[model samples]
Target chain A: MACVVLSLVGISAAPAAEMVRIPAGDYAPPLRAAGEPERVAVAAFLLDERPVTNADFLRFVTAQPKWRRSRIAPVFTDEAYLQHWAGDLELGPLAPPCAPVVRVSWFAARAYARWAGKRLATTAEWELAAAAGFTRADGKNDPELKHAVQQWIAWPVPAILPDAKRARPDFNGVRGLHGLVWEWVEDFSTAMVTGESRGDSGLDRDLFCGAGAVGSRDPGDYAAFMRLALRSSLTARHTTTSLGFRCARDVPEDSSP
Target chain B: MKATAWLCTVLFAAAAMAAPPPMEDCCKEAPPAGPVSARSIYQLDATFCSDTGQCLPLAALRGRPVVLAMFFASCGYACPRLVTDMQAIRGRLPAELRDRAAYVLVSFDPDRDTPAALADYRRQRALDGAWMLLRADSGAVAELAALLGVKYRREPSGNFAHSNLITILNPEGEIVHRREGLGGGLDEAAQAVVAVGKGK
Candidate 1:
């Protein structure tokens, strides 16, 4: 284990992971209607350089045995939580050490994030960070970025994902925001992009049923639309092979030390 | 104002100390007779402040069947109907059975729904007799909402758009039934409460 312990009084540190600082900024998200300001303001914070890897999660489960697949409360996770793993403490042979961890429920992800002295990124923070491409901080309008995201979305989820290192980093030096796995944002359930039960707006009520339906401000942002749709369908306990997560930390106050 | 300041003083003081015990340990003085079921909502470790300014562990209600709803005080639509739905369900129950069951409303807008706000809401609605409105920090609200499968979003107009869900939990804290949308569905929800009360 290459875990380093740096206990600076005011600085938060992680073991065996690289995190980069993301500066504060505002970006209009593409998921809304054409003219509405889908602008989300994200504050300065530290983000994991890559998604939490299988190896990283293995270490976490080892340390916090309460989250072991066998021991976890069903209220916190579904039956498939970490079912890909061979056992409570062992990974399947197909899971690579550096591949992003999959089959983690929101509760497990939240716990792991807490154990790492971090928290799951909020939706605004994640989107703001992900809006960056290799060259531009806000790539929502970059055709190349849009094309790359769409291409990744179209690819079938492989039985085993490749190393997180294989996914290219964005302008903010964060990796695996796309082209690896669908990340679990902290406020995913708040997406609320579904049909209104009271309002009869002639939407596809069948698909929107049992979801929080708020019309998108940018209907043309198909990628964000897909993300919101998927998010709206999920409960916190639901886990899937394509879903994983990364951790983030609030920038420590100067006086905290 | 004095009451608000006093409540804030008490709340912050409690927060400065250790987190209130997890739901399981909250009842250590008189622990639940058996192991908490894995599916019980009590598995979530959250602390909430009641409308009357009583700080409570979520598990404190473990022995009583609860009808819980998530709502905000300032909601212009849906929430008033949601509260009425709860009342309608309560009215459907036999008077004796109603006293045994607890009705809880947790706020989605904690920033605005202080204990005072909740108390005001309770008074305006004339809610009493095993009924309470509660507020917690934003993080706890999110976790409770997640456990209940309630979806909510804050809109630019300062109003909230959310799923209207009323959940019925057994005395052991397991969710027995849920009603979705505003108004109606009282019979099923009431029967759930009655059944859980008998089961306990």
Candidate 2:
């Protein structure tokens, strides 16, 4: 066990995980109340090229026993957290070391990011980064990117996941932003779609104070709507087999490597 | 030089593995005598500052039935009503349970609702010592809100759009009941607090 831990540490120290710069841009929130800004300005930031891998998480749990699957507090996560792993320190067959770590609650993900000296991307930043195409800044007009996103949504997740590092890079050289997994953002709770879609057009003012005069910017954008719906449906402690997350950081003024 | 660096990394990793789990800033206080319940919110290690500027862990509220809600002091619409509803629940409780219960309001706007601001809010609301107005950093506030299943967002206008929720916690810090969306649930919520307080 000691040798295994040492080797994993060695691997992580070999090269720091790649981070891609997402240039400053604007994010159009898919759904917003009437008085909300139409487009939110997002500053430039650094986002991890791929999601955190199982091996990386194994190292974290090995060092921080409180966060280990068996030791985590029930209030922080549901029963299914890291249920796929064989044991506290072992990934086993179901979760390949290189595969993106899944079944992580938002709190657990945030802790991992904090440990790594980074933070989860916000909804606006994540949306801005994911909006890029393979060849251009705007993915909305790119037929190929649109087709890939739609295709991925139509398919069910395979029993065993593939290597996260192998995903194709998008325009900003960031990979797995769309086709790999549903990522957790920093302010996911802010996506306030009421439980009943029928009442979403006009939010229930009683249940959610000041959720006034809400409307979708583009109802035809099924992907954005789906993301918003998924976010809204999740509680912070809830985790799923298909959900994972990547970290983001502020770009320093001098841009040191 | 490279080999030395690798050896240093190995030693650092070993030291980290051997050390106790990292504690949050608010966990410096001596922990409670025994293990908290697995499902208890007191298991959270984050600290919060009361309106009086005293820092304390959530565990400090243990052994007292607590009526808790998350609100921003500047909220114009639902927050005032939420406080009123809480007071009404306290009114409904049996006299013994009423004085024993703790009324807690945790702020969502950490940037705006400083300890002083929370103190001002206490004065404005005429909340007495039994009522605890608390504020913490954004990270700690977010974690507490997550545990309570409260969702809030700061709008561009600086007011918060939030879920109106009132939670009842037993002496052990486990949630016994939750009143969602305000108004009518006060009777049931009060009964829940009574039940938990009397150990029914």
Candidate 3:
């Protein structure tokens, strides 16, 4: 009986090192202005292995009353914020403790990252990490990974999400970079798309200054295009049913876990 | 003991009923010392530095109507036009309402636009005391831009590509009106300021 109790405690405490180290890499943005570089360099960083879960966010809202569903300011989130939860402090049938928390606004996600002593990954870092294949560093040439990603994109989200921990790990031992949910990056508002696909060839110059020179780099990368479209369409206070977030940290100087 | 308590309550009620209601103090400059409204931008806890190098919080502007925009000084296009548009809005307001409103400019390039730079820009633009030029750390600037629905990106050439928007905030620090795509809407923005100032 004592051994079983000890093992249970061990299971609960195992998340201490749940972050995976992503190596320094380069990310090519799908869209860029004429003067902007094609590839942006990303430094080494620590990314959470899975998305932040319902149980994890519950502890945050409970400890910080300002973030609770009933108490959060309207400026930080819309009315749909945390609409899936059973009550201010309860998770209903639709939400499972281990499932990635959804329906959270960008402001709420940013505040949670600050509380966790981490930050939302920049677009360059996130794209670089997500570019990896399951078995290789560059997923662009991996047919199997490409097929899996396309299939996931085609399917509709399930009514209730599966456990975030169940997602398969990729080359860098990170999970849920794709085929789970859309995420909030730190600079999502920088996407700058004009909403009309044809207008993207030369962004609406009147609406956005210096955007007249912007154009797409790769029309064949459907997945990256979709992510950019979603990001540009969003306002900071808006939340969707499938939108969630994970945290990232700068790798420590000493390199110790 | 019960009779004594009942007598005390009756005496207190009689005294309260005899007193007149408190007058509304129209000249009061400070906001009430309580929680801000749920939708107020003053709920943001970020601090900013004015052109004069004074540290100021968003809450400090709580009691006045604010006409705010985000821009950088070195931009050769759009930013100069945005400032001129703000000046137009200020001109449209009645002289009485003009003096009561605050025109604020926040910089997107925190790295380059220090307090000294902002002060120089103010002097060149000939902005009066009613105008405030402010800059903050990048994080605070990003948060404020996000709240105002402004999208901006720094170019390799050190210039910024940003949305052309000017926002009018009421005395409570809630966004009351927005003028998008520039060169027009100065009349409407001035009307909004007048409405908010008069309502207050």
DockQ of each: 0.26, 0.48, 0.48
Cα lDDT of model 1 by residue, A145-189, tens digit: 887898999999999889997788888888878788999989887
Candidate 1 overall Cα lDDT vs. reference? Answer: 0.79
Which ten residues in a row are the worst by lDDT in model 2 chain A? A195-204
Candidate 1 residue runs with Cα over 4 Å from true position:
A1-14, A30-36, A140-147, A195-213, A255-257, B1-31
In model 1, what are the clashing residue pairs, if there are any? Answer: A32-A217, A32-A218, A33-A217, A33-A218, A194-A212, A194-A213, A195-A213
**Candidate 3 local lDDT, A89-172, one digit each (tens):** 899999999889999998899888877878899988999999999999999998878988898899899979989999999999
Q: What is the interface RMSD of each candidate, in Å?
A: 4.7, 2.0, 2.2
Global lDDT of each model?
Answer: 0.79, 0.87, 0.86
Error of 3 at B134 (Å): 1.6
Model 3 chain A: lowest-lDDT 10 consecutive positions: A195-204
What range of 10 consecutive residues in model 1 chain A has the weakest lDDT sum?
Answer: A5-14
> Candidate 2's residue-wise lDDT over A1-257, tens digit each?
99898767645642246899999999889998778898999999999999898988887787667889999988889999999999998999999999999999999998888878898999999999999999898998989899999999998998788899999889999999888889999899888776322223335676778766567687677888899999988988889999999999999889854
Error of 3 at A3 (Å): 34
Poorly placed runs, candidate 2 (over 4 Å): A1-16, A195-203, A253-257, B1-32
State each model's TM-score restricted to chain B: 0.82, 0.82, 0.85
**iRMSD, model 1, in Å:** 4.7
Best by lDDT: 2
Off by over 4 Å in 3: A1-17, A195-203, A254-257, B1-26
